[model samples]
Target chain A: MNKELVEKIKNDPNYQELVSKRSSFSIKLTIAMLAVYFAFILTIAFKPALLGTPLSADSVTTVGIPVGIAVIIFAFILTGIYTKRANTEFDDLTNKIKNAIKEH
Target chain B: MNRTFLFLVLGSIAVFASGAIEGEVQKQALNMSAIVMFLIFVSATLGITYWAAKRTKSAKDFYTAGGGITGFQNGMAIAGDYMSAASFLGISGLVYMKGYDGLIYSIGFLVGWPIILFMIAEPLRNLGKYTFADVASYRLRQTPIRTLAASGSIATVVLYLIAQMVGAGKLIELLFGLNYEVAVILVGVLMILYVTFGGMLATTWVQIIKAFLLLSGASFMAIAVMAHYDFSFGALFTHATELKGIAIMSPGGLVSDPISAISLAIALMFGTAGLPHILMRFFTVSDAKEARKSVFYATGFIGYFYILTFIIGFGAIVMVFKNPAYLDVVKNAVDGTSPILGGSNMAAIHLSHAVGGDFFLGFISAVAFATILAVVSGLTLAGASAISHDLYASVIKRGNVDSMKEMRVSKIATVILGIVAIIMGIMFEKQNIAFVVGLAFAIAASANFPILVLSMYWRKLTTRGAVVGGSLGLATAILLVILSPTVWVKILGYKTAIFPYEHPALFSVAVAFIAIWFFSITDKSENAKEEQEAFEAQYIRSQTGIGAEGASH
Candidate 1:
């Protein structure tokens, strides 16, 4: 690509907005995921019996089953949130940036 | 022409059938249903390959199906690539054997997808063409960076191939009652045909179909298991706890220590983003929007699939573990404990028969075989792209090679990779290969992931830093694996491991980041300055998709 176009896009406020919003959003989501996963892993490492405890006194199922499945579901949910925002909000900013460059 | 291809496929199947019959007479009764189902799957895939071959006229078409795949389709294909035979059988088998411990792996694997979607997927789609090396080498020195990326890709691919191949051979032996060598050869041959002729389009279709079949089959098994318990997981777990004890509901010996747990978690998480086959799936979409969408769908499908496998595992524990019919009585008598017919890895396979009978067993067996073919084909294509697109086209020829020549080179590489996979599969048949996949993940997380991430994110990453840091990370990961317990104690017959932990990603990734930071800041070269300056354009393209290859309609 030409230098002028890149410079123009780089300096565009929409591009800046898109980059900052997306990066922060992604970083937050990433931190959330790592936190959840590492929490689960650490729990497994240090306190195995905690997860082994049944839901109720008479219950056969342990707490780990739902917890593990929750982590998986949380991951999917996080992806959904990101995709929804990226396709709608961030993508709008990107299109504005592109249009600005084209008109120039 | 179609008739000729059909004849060729049938002729090969005939030869394999004869060999299987001769080999199985000494083992046990032949599984005619499995063989028939497998033949049908193989014939259908071969027909898809024949069709894809017609449309694959350009290098772009060969690599990314001309970027024509929709978001949802690419999502299914990505899920197909991720849900290999290893994850399906291996994780379920772990659950069957160790109970709640298996969920650790499932969670680790699923967690990578969200991270990939959040960070890597869009930038990757906005930047690269064909292989991931395109992104890594975007502003850096092409030759060294491409060389490094290709080495990492090939190493990851070959290691993963060996694991998949060995597992395929053994699983087919138990499931199809076929000879191990025949099974390996069958996988290698089918992979070669799919990739060499059909390219990305065929590979994607094959993966999607296999993913669909596997999901449906596993769903059926899970539903069947739940049906027996009135659709209550509590009832199922109650039975499992009664049979296997309550210890099965908690963590076992898989990750006993804190460091090992964290190290393994890191490897499983980032190693996925570094995987070439998975990363390559991004470019198959038309734009970054589709790329993002694909990950969303892939994560959901994969997470749902893992949940099914967990159910299947617990189901197997309750159904197949105590059943005398599925147990090998002689072995059980000697061991004083009932063991399933083909070991714990066959837990899901045995559960298929217990729950769904011979016909369903035949279907699951075929699906498992198809899963292997799909995974290996994806691996082979990635490896070939590394060799041809990165090494031959860009590095060796200085990006001057014609598309046709590059395509031919990739085809040749695919054939070579297939042969090597088959041979290695046979060679490693008796050896313990459980560590191979882990090592692949380690290398990917350490080497490929660091450089790719740094090149895109770190403004000061020079060619020197990337080459030095990536090579050190790669070397360290491999070296640590060699000195770790899995290899040193188990394979090499050493009494004690030099590396205390089995996983090396934590240390190796730290080394890579530190080394890259150290080298890039210390460098005083004019070229380094220019590379730093070039990052703005690369970043713009990465963020905004301006000047991105194949983005223009």
Candidate 2:
């Protein structure tokens, strides 16, 4: 509720670091996931045959199966990447900022 | 291992709810095993309700389970809240009928989890209380914003609830041989009982149980399908293609259009984040970290479940499609193909029979039925909370009411909602309500998602901007859907649709974002300036969880 505290936290080094680091990290991961998903969608629309074709001549499996699985796997991996960083790096910075505000 | 075993038990209860063992098809005499299975589910959940009633002593417990839920529990509860009968029966039915196109729904639904994890969950957990409108109204005019948000929540919940209820009625008619009215009333009574007495604690446990049942049952079906193919994806595809042709493995006709596909993709992705019921789950956890972790576990569970559905579809393709035992003996004269035992929606049910026989068939059917019950309860709770908490307490009383009185109002609202769901379910029994869910999503994405995102990140957002822009988004989404092919041509029997596309999110969502941005920047009201100034305090609390509401425990 304090105007001075608001100004102080906004200018605090720890707060700025947390915001910048977390926002950029989240934004990059979100864009990556969106690209992969949209690429899959667009390919279905424009280049249908590419996903329809079999992976190899002998196998009955199409290229789309692995790609679909890959998308699911990719989601988990991205989530892991974010969670790992958030739990370790981001939480540490957030705690430091909280403590500093409390002391002040 | 313990968790997996728990899911198996939970999943088996769902099958019991479906009532499949006795009569998947043929109006044969009722089966006792299925009845017993359903009774077990009934008794167990009723016991949970009784236990939850003992602890639900205040408004907080009624709405958020006192924020005492753990990350894993909340994750499974979310899955239960989300994975409706539509996901289990509808996607499998789509896969059974259309093949590879079914996975599009799978992927579209799964992608929203990560977005929520990154942006909405933490800030929402910190800034809001009980409902999403709490956060959206943080620095704005509380009355108008809360009113608009409550309206949006009710619209989405009611439409979605009707779809589920109607689907339940039809499914029960087939699986249990019950009259349509009776089935709808049963669902209504049970949902009211869960929310009115047990509240969020009961609702959370019910969802957790339902999610487990769904995951384990789907897993069992998928495993059985794989075992038949010697655990080889290639073998399953080979067998499936033999029945449906090579297109079964391709994107096929369901998504050939670029515009429609992208529109659908936008609706599913953004809509999940904006859903009132889904957003409400964030408040059940103790902190932002648990909220984040809940999404992580949800994504993992939901992703794994979808992969199983792919197999289940292919399994049905090989086992149930064109198979004499699971089909009508009389063939269609022109098509020369036998109708499936109960219809395409029962494809997963028949596949259970093919692999696990009578008992498993009954089990899967009950799980599908239980899926509907759990989903309906969640939607009811959300709608009730919107009415009592946002509308009555914040707007009418201006936050001056007692907690006990508010809780009483919420229970009354739940009863009203349950009756409304039943009535709407019966009325829309013959209507094509499948597209209604899509319209709900479009409204949520267009109206709620844009306003929510802007309110959090954009410091310049004004009360006028959020209300007007959100109302426009809401209105446009509804209007466009009415003019679109699904409603205009198909439902109204028009020769041609004014709006060519089936989805409205692609256009409406953009309109909302633009409107909110343009209006906020142009506004010169003194209150607007004050609202903008207050954003700094909100931003600090949202980011750092400082001075945010704490868990009572």
lDDT scores of the candidates, listed in order: 0.86, 0.83
After superposition, which runs of candidate 2 have C-alpha atoms over 4 Å from their true positions?
B1-29, B331-334
List, in order, the clash count of every candidate structure: 0, 12
Clashing pairs in 1: none
True contacts kept of each: 0.90, 0.60
lDDT of 2 at B28: 36
lDDT score, candidate 1: 0.86
Off by over 4 Å in 1: B1-28, B551-553
lDDT by residue for model 1 over B303-413, one digit each (tens)? 999999999999999999979888878778999688777667678989999988999988998998898899899999999999999999999999998999999999999
Question: Candidate 2, residue A88: CA error in Å?
Answer: 2.0
Maximum-lDDT candidate: 1
Q: What's the distance in Å from true for residue B127, model 2?
A: 0.6
